[model samples]
Target: MRLTDFTELMRNEFGTMASDSMLRDHVLSDLGNRTGAVAIEEGVDPREVWLALCRDFDVPRDRWYLHPS
Candidate 1:
């Protein structure tokens, strides 16, 4: 799961919009608080971030593999 994959997940769920960036930023920031390791600072695993997002938002498990690439 790359950043592009994560962003694509956001687009798939939320549709295309500039607000997607804000949503991503907000989620990532909150993730840092919850995990105690900022992704950018320590290079968090993308799969971990994705799983955390899914758990935090209750996203459907079916969509978990919807990442395009």
Candidate 2:
């Protein structure tokens, strides 16, 4: 997915402030223990970062992919 899509998904799922905090502070093990923003800057896939976030936060499996109502 594009970076824009990743940004929107993060905001949609975690609110603007929380998403920003996570991207800045949450270290993702799957990305070599790098924060989301750093990992993305180093060329990690946003989808991979999102999945790592979901795993770290224990987000429900059903919610991994967005579903329109």
Instruction: Name the best candidate (by lDDT).
Output: 2
> Judged by lDDT against the true structure, how good is candidate 1?
0.59
lDDT of 2 at 33: 88
Report lDDT per candidate.
0.59, 0.87
Q: Compute the lDDT of residue 17 as modeled in candidate 2.
A: 100
- Write model 1 residue lDDT over 16-38, tens digit each, in one string: 67325434454554565643125
Give the candidate number with the greatest TM-score. Answer: 2
Could you tell me which 10 consecutive residues in candidate 2 have the lowest summed lDDT? 60-69
Candidate 2 wrong stretches, greater than 4 Å: 66-69
Q: List the residue pairs that clash in candidate 1.
A: none
Candidate 1 Cα errors over 4 Å, as ranges: 16-37, 66-69
**Tens digits of per-residue lDDT for model 2, 28-61:** 8888989999999998888888889989988887
In candidate 2, which residue pairs get closer than 3 Å at backbone N, Cα or C atoms, i.e. clash? none
Please give each candidate's TM-score.
Answer: 0.56, 0.89
